[model samples]
Target chain A: IEYVEEAVEAVDKDKWKGIAVYVDHIDGVIHPVTYELIGKARELAKKINHPVYAIMMGHHIGSQCEELLHYEVDKVFVYDKEELDRFKMEPYTKAFEDFVENIKPTAILMGATPVGRQLAPRLAARLKTGLTADCTILDINENTDLVQIRPAFGGNIMAQILTPNHRPQMATVRYKVMDAPERKDAAQGEIIRCNIDSKELASKVSVLDIIAKEKEQFIEASEVLVVAGRGIKKEEDLAMLKELAELLGGQIACTRPVMEAGWLEAKRQVGLSGRTVRPKLIITCGVSGSVQFTAGMNNSEQIIAINKDENAPIFKAAHYCLVGDLYDIIPNLISQIKAGKTVSA
Target chain B: MNILVCIKQVPDSNKVEVDPVTGVLKRNGVESKMNPYDLYAIETALRIKEKLGGSITALTMGPNQAAGVIREAFAMGVDHGVLISDRKFGGADVLATSYTISQGIKKSGTYDLILCGKQTTDGDTAQVGPEVAEWLGIPSLSNVSKVTELKAGSMVVEMDMTHEIEIAEIEYPCLLAVDKDIFIPRLPSFVKKQETKDREIRVITLADLEDREEKHYGLNGSPTQVQRIFPPEVNNHREVWNGEGSELTGRLLSKLKELKFA
Candidate 1:
């Protein structure tokens, strides 16, 4: 069997229509990343000369579709029902899968989140399409193919991927990677109530409970952030970082290692697996910046990194790099701030 | 009960580097290790084996060298190993990779449960596990953070969806892509490593799979195309300071003050 690359011109490319963004919402509250996807989709739509559409799926989510109109999507498709009230993979996958089959969107963008990560793959399998996950950047080529760029192999390099031969080129963009467009005062978009098939709502998995793992703080809304990583020797070391965050009138966050060590709750971890934040100022202590962590916070207004190893990758991303033991430097910075002395360099 | 845990050998994440000029990854001699995420899946299987008394078969789809991960699984207490290796399977993407693994699983035999890491560190696509389940015609779940109940024919699990954690129950012969911290993954025992040093790893090649259509196996079956590769834009402006701890601390404080952060 010969391995032949499919010609880009082989498919009926013009048959695909609008750019679609999946609206991630639960209990009537939409995830902010949905708006970010809208913002990105708007940009990509302009490049490809297509209207942007938002696909909303959940029980009683029609009102949310109306709200999505404010974000400038040309159309909103709503699949609201009791079956979708809770997210079971099978039903949600089926709903979005059927929508794509019907509407034939040129591209579908989703948040690189747990639900998105889980659902996107299954749908791609069903459609026999291609999907690039955790994308930090999205662009449209002259040929109208969606160029999905993401950090690969532990963030060492960026890989630009394309699904040239497949319709509905899919990519999951990480939260905070793209800016969220402001909602307009008056909604102008049309909302189409999608009639979902009963069979598509069938699920093999049954949900038992939905609960918060920890009391949530809006890390995305924080003005200042202090994050810890593997540099912190033990779980107890998190307290010092937390105190620094408190003194600075900010919240505490961690790299994946700290959360995995049970020092901080997963909600407080700032990385690809966790929440994405764009604070006014972010101070990373003992964090060896990986693309996973940097992708979550690189958009912050200012970044200060404190690590003992001078060669740590965090320095490459930081606006201000401090090479020393965070254990020693943090206390001094805290006491100096308390003393009201100008410590300008 | 019988169990099968899927694992993969990936280039060590920390050692992967890209060439600045060519915009291609410099992969001449990078060392390979069991994917860090797969360790958790193996640990989960070992724990389940402890409670349920099941024989564990660790499986993978890669080159012959991928047998290293299977041996590592044996060091962690897997009873058997299988490496689905063949030249025709090279350069396969997630879709084809999952289909081939499903074919290998069918050839190996059936099991009550199948476990895999949420995603691989290299491909970073968390799709393979669920797609394999799709191929095998079984229910699958992802980001499963915890297992709360294990009944005779069903199991309940807590899935971490980031914003909220949802608990779900599924019947036997299902697939799960487990998340980190599901358990504190135990280190491979030195004693077990010594004992399993000579263990034979069953090799499954193209001839072993039920569907031996070569065209459906590798790059020919992959749909995604790589248009280009490059390094992400980095801020080149950086100031590295080296001094005594106290002096460096003072300098950092002063720098914070200069930036109005103090």
Candidate 2:
């Protein structure tokens, strides 16, 4: 094994540094979480009188850098290279490691997507720093420490973590937990293309083939969701829920049990372990809300729950709770919508 | 091929309570069980061992009571158990925890492969497996959904990268964080449990590590500090409607219209 010296010693301990938001993108299209973190970094940076930097790395991603310039970031660091076209762990870690050694940012924020979760920890370990993962909230203290808050212990508790003694305090914030800033028409930030060392781009792991899974709508981006719970009897019953979902121009989501039952794909599971969604409207059927399940969708604009048990925990998180069998309530509701009976506004 | 499977013990229930005043988890009476995800890792290791004719060792880092999980692994057919428990190793975040585990792995005998669950139920970071691999300077893969082939010197597996599944060949002396449902974990055999009940669980402490630096073992080694922990704020103000199905459906339509959801 080739022993690479730790990069922590290379950090300039006393240098004043800004907040860096890792700009995550695929095929040159930026992830919305990047903008959300930019908004958050801007908020935390202002208190400490520091600038916000967006770090973008990909193949032929200059246009995305141009797009990032309108979001009030002070500077954009671009690492455009063929080695970065795919999200290989080693090259991405090396590029970011070089960036951290050079800039010595006080803190780094990344989306808790698969790529970000993988990369953030590797960088943190290489730099001998700390990272809090899947953070739902971010704030700054008087000592310039970044406060990272996220659900812990199966969403029953919230932990407030701080990397007080580390440079570039790192965290992977969950997507859709924060609001993305509105993009301004006028571009303002400077873009600087960074160079990566050739040796740093070498990796031992190689991808043999890429198989795209069957296309399914991502529940995170859906505006409306019809969620099924354990109360749904069997696999065939999911079709009824799907009909209701389609009639309402929405998609279907479910709890862990429903997903585990193979009635729906794993992507449709909404909970601490699954996708965190903030849809405009969410109607849950026969779902007893656990903290794990509610933690993911409590931020929806409108929550209406239908369950037979009056004391089901889902009521606490719902704005409107209906106590009735979903088997009875759903078919009637579907028929009402099918009959074109519009309630007067 | 020798395999090392990393497992953890977590609260049996997700409803573990927190002390409002102390901001600490009230784990006094709550039962602990093997983390649900770790079963998949153990099962994967057992499957690989069964095919390749080798031994499997289960390792965990926690209090003395955590050795229970190690014993549970034995019932599932693990050959050996190692527990890294020390008061100094308390209150570790991911970096320190991974570092400590890496050191423990070094102290234990070398293995051709290491397996870990995608994440633990209590922490749910999914970061430790890769971080430990980074500390060991070995190639690591996470979200492994299927193990296609196990060779003498290497293994081929498919990784679920969310957008796409990529098949990759990783050499031995590497680590893999297997996702759930890669294989259904078998039930603990009562026969195996009675046979291995007295198997010794090797314990490693800070004194046993090659790196004797006290500053790198526990809370002192951890860079992240918990400012506070509190119960999640739950919104309890809700309009409860109970009525006949026909009337409730009509009322729900009106409510949806009021909210402009229809």
Candidate 3:
């Protein structure tokens, strides 16, 4: 299609009135991402010159619509009920799809999170509209009046998208990357409550249970981490490494290979496949820095690497580099530190 | 599921540079690329949709030039694309960028699954994914290695870790920031270039918004900022070892002994 035709065909909303966004929320614990989407809608509504409203599919998120108003969004649709309290696919997707077909929004934005990731594709099928995921940025074109700009190919490329022939250009945004508008203390925003269809709540998926992972700290929120790779060779040797990590008051960590070798627990893995850590201090032993490995811990404020190989990439990111075998280095340092060695945080 | 994937167009890190005096990146003439990890995220979503039957819409927020990445996404089979461009968004930290993208998605209003690479090669901070999830008030799963099963409204997946696999079934309206192993990305079609520019890239500006609340759009809301950018420092020198395998091992062991590491 020609650019002009593609651009003009996108805004055909005579058949579409408003786009409804589907968000997953549990009671008492409102996900921060929903605020980010509402915040974005506040801005996007102005760009497209359309009303941007948010929809939450949970049992008790109706009270939180006030939070959406903090970002100045136009409206919030609450579909809260006992069966819809927890996230289940069939009912939630059906309800959201029905709402979308009824509201006919120009577009929808969701958090590219676990729930959104699982639900978006299914909802897109229900709505038969395009859905973009994990976009770091967004905006509209004056000439084309389409949403634009999302990164692709592991941040190597930027893609501009538009639902020229479709109503409600759909997309999702990742966390910490999008702007979350503030809630004004004095400002009171209007909240409209709509009666939801009750039949949509009965679905096939069931929430068997909900519990937090054991001994698993949210690595993203941690301040310090100590990682061991091939250098710590033996599972037994990890004891000494743990001893060292103990002195520093940090959690134990490892590379993908170490996890593959069973020297550490899977939760300790730090890399592309593992957790991406942004601790204040990240210490490494025997880990050669690969592009994949670096992506995990490269954000650490202070990096210290002890490796025998002089040419390891870990040295490049390290603030302090010690060249030697880990066997001698670790034990000696552990013993010395145990002997009341003064250490600096 | 209607899935959306977000990727970044960044200067290839290996070729990136910093202005030593200013601690700022020099982007006037550096080569750029789509983050490699994001390729896995997008492809994985596409694969899920293909099996489950859905569509993939790709979007980006950058300068007018960022449209290049969007076109690439289209060729890879994303059904549509969007470009959120505006001068006011320039130099935005993660928080601002998150708000801007959320706004664009809100306006677009068509999505079920949102996918992203764990982090970017440049900032290397994975906070954006979680932060966006926080703002959107949805369930977010990060560092996902594989989407094991997608049944009903629940997603059963494994998070690849250093030691053991973590299997969790997340409810819908969830966000997932993925690792490259999620899926092998599709190759760009040669015809993408021929047909890319022809596709309209929708762009939005600050003036386009009704509220126009400038208090925290860009730098105002960010808690962390790029205080400086520098080439990763390199230290230590190499003592090349040259000899037969036995000799190399013996020498290595001896050197360890001499260094009191044995």
Candidate 4:
């Protein structure tokens, strides 16, 4: 049919080759999300019969390029320079844009981290291509189009999107949403060293300093999490929730509203705009369960949502749901844990 | 210095009723409000204007009713308002939306700074602000949690980069997509709303833009297409229990033990 003819002519499948994943590195340490992207890229590459390439950029990142070869990437492109020591929007975008313009990869994937979020849009604009943000699922269609699936409308709906006409279709995938590929001791790949022009490093914005967040409670590292939401009413009520989390031997986290209320640190907020956590167990207290907040913790192994409203959407995602006043339930649970009176199953 | 803040009109998340039969979003009666995050952007602009002494303009793109958000911005003390709306601009994605706004901004008067929300409740792409900045050829900073120093030519701000907070300085004529809680947003004033009721909102269509190519205005210019949209699959298997505090706690603990969590 004419539709088939148009589809065939629309994409020159032979022109687009290789799936490139950007390895986000900082302070000589590679983020785990890079490995996850590598694993995902390898899988997608297998489907479309394309090579997987990992692109890295940083000062003194030559030694790091070899480490990327241990993953499933067929080739690694490293852009090393002194001016690239700090993370600037201009230089980073320039490096990637220049590389894409030359190599013309089929697709580019990045972590939905802070740097990725800022860099992806600008680079996509410069390339005149499409970029999907915070994608939870990615796939390749028959036409070799990158199927980017993401939650939209405050997480009320899932929208499947495709960039049919653009080259090097780009997307930023959320961390911990995909499995990190295991490292091989004797893996093999090609490492290409790219030269960067100093002029390209010039940036309108300059980083003054990177202040490390104080490591008080690392929720991402915790096995169990106790999260509070805006429904908790007052900041003082956080004491009870904290005590319950303590009794449960878990760290205390919160939704964006709780942190906005100054009840918790920004580090403790978990959502699309906050941190993505995959704890073994997460108990949400008084959370109305907006999609933004739930998207961050939906991957937890076990979920227990406690809210007074039974119809609250949080229940839809919970393995165990308790519809009751958190004030009435948390205190009792705390005392029971303290007394250790419950018989073990 | 003049400041322009970009706001968006989105369906109220709480009231987005879905058609049960078709599973399509029922947009007819759903109440529309200014994007929640844009309130933070407006607050940031207001604070900067208060300290630096500048005029503030609020801009948006949508149907004529989207002028409602501009009016709301006026209620919050914006000096002026502009709405870019046209039938040709319908079904625009983030790329086309940002491009259209950038064109509208170019047609409008000049400003030293542009502000936008981190993301919209509907599109939630968080890309339009930076893309608009790219079109304007201005430096942009995203996830800006704190505005530290505002100078005559340059500004220093702290951006939440997830694991670390990086303080960065960008010269004037830059854009910032401020994160939430930059400042507690002030409530819209009824007095200002009454005074600004008759104020004219500048409306620009595709014809008004410098680039009048119809192909670059709406779905024709959009790079991505929505193949499908549906309500997320919900897990309806849930057990509800009503009991005294201690009894409910025991039941929950026992269930946790059964699930091997204990």
**Best by the lDDT measure:** 2
Report the C-alpha lDDT of model 1 over A1-345, residue by residue, as the tens digit.
344543333557789988999888778788888998999999989987899999988887766678888888899988888999877778888889879988999899998778787788778777777788889888998677888888877665788898877787888887767877867878887998888878668877898889887634778867789998888888876777787787666789989988888888888889888998988789999999999999999978778898988889999989888888888787776777767644321
Proportion of true contacts reproduced by candidate 4? 0.65
Ranking by lDDT: 2, 4, 1, 3
TM-score of chain B of 1: 0.88
> Which candidate has the highest DockQ of all?
2
Task: Look at candidate 2 and tell me the lDDT of residue A266.
Answer: 96
Which candidate would rank higher by TM-score, 1 or 3? 1
Can you list the residue pairs that collide in candidate 4? none
Model 4: per-residue Cα lDDT over B1-262, one tens digit each? 7999999999876435556776666788778999999999999999998898979999999999999999999999999999999988888888888899999999988989999999998888899988999989899999999999998899999998766889999998999999998898999999999999999999999889999987776777778888777776754556777666667788877765454344
True contacts kept of 2: 0.79
User: For model 3, how does the per-residue alpha-carbon lDDT over A91-165 read when each residue is reduced to its tens digit?
Assistant: 666677767766777677777666676566555544434455566667755432345456443343444545555
Cα deviation at B194, candidate 4, in Å, is 1.0
For each of the candidates, give the backbone clash count: 1, 0, 134, 0
Model 2 whole-model lDDT (C-alpha atoms): 0.88
Compared with the true structure, what per-residue lDDT tens digits does model 2 show for residues A232-322? 9988888889988887768999999999888899999999999999987899998999999999999887799999999899999998999
For candidate 4, the lDDT comes to: 0.86
- Per-residue lDDT tens digits for candidate 1, residues B1-262, read 7899999998875546677786667877888999899999999998888998979999999988899999899888999999999988887878788889999999998999999997888877787988888778788899999989888998999998765789999988899999988998899999999999999999999998889988677876676777677766755556777777788778877765555455
